[model samples]
Target: MLRALRSVRSGLHATYLESYFISQCDKLSSKWLTRGLHSAPAEDVAEDAGVTAAVGARSGERPNKSNRNQEVRPFTSIPGPKPLPLLGNKLFFTTIGGYPMERYWESVQRIYEKYGPVVKVERFSGSLDMVIAFRPEDTRKMFQAEGIYPMRPGLGILTHYRSKRPQWFSSPGLVPGNGPEWRRLRSVIHPLLRREVINAYRPAQTEVANDLVRAIAASNQHNTKQDPSRHIISDTLSILFHYTLEAVGVVSLGMRLGCLASTSANCQAQSIIKANIEVLNVLGESMLQPPLYKLFPTRGYRRLSAAQDTICRQVDVEVARRREELALDPEGFTQRHPFLASLMNNPDLSSQDVFLLLIETLQGGIDATATTLGFCLYFLAGHPAVQDKLLKEVQHVQPEIHTLQGLPYLRAVVQETLRLRPSAAARSRVIQEDTIISGYCVPAGTFVVSPPNVACYDPQIFPGA
Candidate 1:
């Protein structure tokens, strides 16, 4: 019965392919008509099976007529790993933990070593297109492909409630989708992330950093100064979270989280942000297990929702307060460092758009900066010599992180860290159109990804791996 079904399907596919090919010929004919060109012979058309297959695939049709003498050519199917029924390859992926990508990295390399550079894997209902580029050149090809060989949809764990918070940092199009909005936001923020803009934040950052240091010192003072050895490793993430809130506070709303003082005070706002971020961590982790996430109604989700609501309400209040303050002194908008204020003053952007942008920036800034800085520390810790080199470089300018700006080695350290342990490591996008990679002709509308684990570790780029 299965054989019969296959046969019937094959026949249908062949018919579809023939119709698709005829349509392509029509298109070609239309183009040539303007030049007064005659139609090519039938044999000429028949010889172009690759072109026919491509056209058919584009039109959502298939050619199942004959496997014989046909150019399997590049990739008839996007290759991947095979999986067991129902469960797929979930078990295999889950068994290897602590940096999901690392395990996948190892598996991908092993598969490529055994088979070739590109292989296929079955991931639940999805088919994963895996590639192990052993050289920097191959890595460049993948990155250069960008929109073509883009990051995959983040694991389900990271996407929970992503849509719920339109005000979410991810809302600025940073969450993952490939679209005009994403492009727009990226353009606006990239310049701000440049060394000059980052340096602009140094005054504020140093204030915050000093506050953190002071807090630690005070804790030790309270403890009778008996060898206070808790390393002042700025939870780059937490600090970033604080810094972002404060930055947006001053720039957007003419307010400040007063996080420096708040950290010591453990105020309501500080607690709320911490709670929400923690909830994010929990939810993000939970997204890994589909069944478990589905079966259980965790307290973390409730806490997260509550935290978000609280934060949003607080933001609304802050906005209202700023409006009243601006009413008293109209020049405040121009005078203040608030980014949102400048944007608000702009005649172009709507108030709603400005508000949404502020929220996205604040939230995204909080987490992303910290995650990046944390990852940098992670690499630095692993490579003590690298850390030592960095420390020596910083010694000449100790306590002046801004001086490290544009320093080649410092920049390399940061870039290398991002390459190795990206904060938002994996990403996903729907294939916009039919595309080819490593000889695989993938159909449009399919979800595709370039896992950083694989991209960063590509032997061609990093070599030693």
Candidate 2:
């Protein structure tokens, strides 16, 4: 619901994260005017709603009275850093000491500045030819071209891994695949967005959060006894990771991971955290690199594979346990575990499908959500006045923060945080048909990368930027 929430220098774990953060609709003082919080004029809100609606539809643009041939420029006409020989634009990425994938959106932003709104990236080793579109109107139009199914074509490293291990990921599950199959798998998740569904998980979520606070208190209490000053110093991120993994475990796998319970650093939960981060980190790097892994198990591929294996094994074990229990009790199991139950009962899915899909939601979702929430807490920590207001509002909301009933500012804070420093920096989709972007004709099947960060940071789009 309102995730990516962190900032418990005192262990603001879980929705103990939930119990703390509050959403208020009142306009924050001049302090938040810069971030353009809830105080925005109605026109801006209306415009944003339009964009959100279009994006939500997830359908592509239809031909607007022969707009396809209305003097639209060729796809090659778009400007970007020039490619050279066989290496092509691979020079900008893949090479040692080249652009790191960790700051990929930065690279895209620079290209946006140098190449204007529509930038074409050509001839990267394993990547489809890409067009980086920056303008908002173009963004709206591009999504319109998405037609019935939006195709996002660049998870080469992941597709490669799952391809190798056909046993686990029979058809790449959902994350890296597209078309009818992807749409069907994705459909099963839509019901999860319902308020009733989220409400059902509230008690368990609260427990996980309380456990997070307990874990933090326990660790800091131990360290402080060793040295009174140790209380002042804490690996906040590490503790947050424990909470996030455990929280994710409750929702995704319908169980507590006991990450907070594990005192050992080499615990399975700790390993999953480590391996999960690596998978994301290296996957970003490999996406822009040469397709060496295609021919053989390159070092990056091997590393990704190993990390995936670690995550997959855990999922496999859980799936087997669930399956056995499911056999013994079907309806009871479904009532107890909504997430796993949905997957377990899907006629379209296999045991492997259940495991792989859980891997995405459990491990991958955990890393991104935790980091985002960490940023949110960091922002609140810097602005004490904002924190004070939030505390007052939080108390006002009392036990209803999850519904976000009275928490508009809290929602604004998250929105602004995501705009400023999002975990998923780049949003992309492969065009399913010929599309018009910034007056240029982008061919169907072209990889389109939209850097929302660039747009988010645009002074024109964001009032304060």
Candidate 3:
């Protein structure tokens, strides 16, 4: 029965691949219908991938979903894992089998088992699609400098906004889409992400990290009897968010959020940032599945859209205020050290451009760094030996601001955490033209997903994947 099933599935895959290749050339019209799930469209197939795309996939069997003899371009020619009907290889991701995070990796590996290097999965609803890459080479293809493929827009809430003014709700730089305006913003703001600027931003980063340590220490001292490893004294993630936002604001506009000193956050910026976080949490899940998910709206979505407008308007106000300030004192303003001030001297940048760049940088850098800190803590709690080694390494350094440069083990821990808990689990690209990746002919605009989570755990690469 297994052999017969394989035979049937192979036939269907062949037809599917052939049909997709033809569709790419404008040779065939691949009419899509998402009724009762007869033919699972490519987008649906990608979403089913989820975290499995980000995490690595293990070996598994490919179930046959066809009764006819169809030939898919062999796996040797195409680069990704094999697909199963409607589900693609996503069914291999089993959420119930292991610890929450580990289970995600297990499920991903299962897809790799059946599919091979690159596998596609359908997220439940019309949320974005996913692609899991088993090989490092395949993964590297995604980071191409040319904007042929950029990041995915599946981060959810960033895409869904209810605002009257476009400027009011603009993301600036955080969300991903390709167009002339996006390109204009990217060109002017790209310099801020340069290596030197990231280095310049580190002083603020170290200050924040030290503040976090002190806060944690104070809490631990107060709860002397509690286990340091297990006690959740405070949310380090929240602290990091404020720190990053304030850091960006200081660097970009010479403004301060005053988050580090505040005992309780109550500012408008704080409220809006908090609300945005809530929206992200909601949109992230809501986007995972398709139209059926419409049956339920999570609290993240339930929050009145009007509040979102309030935040955008606040951003616009800041933009306008900065512009007026720049006009009134052009010479002194250009000399200012703030990020926005620095951009003022650049002929290519406008006030709107500066605002967008600053906002986007703040949005992208904050949650990602905070979440990363949390993941680092989680690992440190679980692996004391690693923590001890890191501490020892830190101690050997002079503890000066420059000391961070020579800390290898500290860097290793950070790298390991990033690998294990990437800020963005999956990176996506839209195929611009008909292309053959790993031998499969992918049509233009068909969302191509390559999850990085799997790369972190690959045993051949990471040794314990």
Cα-based TM-score, every candidate: 0.62, 0.81, 0.65
For candidate 2, the clash count comes to 18
lDDT of 1 at 14: 11
- Give per-residue CA lDDT, model 3, range 1-465, as digits (tens): 011111011001111111111111110111111111222233222211222221222212222221222222322243443445565534333343221333444555566676686665444223334445554444333433225335354444444442223654444244644556566666667665454554444555455445544544443323337633334445445554665565555565555556656625448557756865765555555443342323444354455244455555666676677778888987665555445666766787654556556556555555665555556556676676776666666553333343323655665565666666655555566545333344233334446665555555555455554
For TM-score, the strongest prediction is 2
Candidate 2 differs from the real structure by a C-alpha RMSD in angstroms, to one decimal, of 7.2
lDDT per residue as tens, model 1, 27-62: 232232211112222221212235466556445466
Candidate 1 similarity to native, TM-score: 0.62
Residue 24's C-alpha lDDT in candidate 2? 17
Better of 1 and 2 by TM-score: 2
Q: Backbone clashes in each candidate structure, one number apiece? A: 21, 18, 48
The 0-to-1 C-alpha lDDT of every candidate, in the order given, reads 0.46, 0.65, 0.47
Ranking by lDDT: 2, 3, 1
Which scores higher on lDDT, 2 or 3?
Answer: 2
Across 1-465, the per-residue lDDT of candidate 2 in tens digits comes to 124332244322233534233111112211233243333343322121233222322243432223233334455667876777766777665434255554576666766777798888786544468788776566665676787977886588889899888778777657788888788778877676466666666677767767766766766533456754434315656766777788778767777888877535638888898898889778777766667899988999989999989988887787778788888998998888877787788897776667777887787657666666667777776676776666665544434334554576666676677677655555578777666676566767777876666767777657677
In order of TM-score, best first, we have: 2, 3, 1
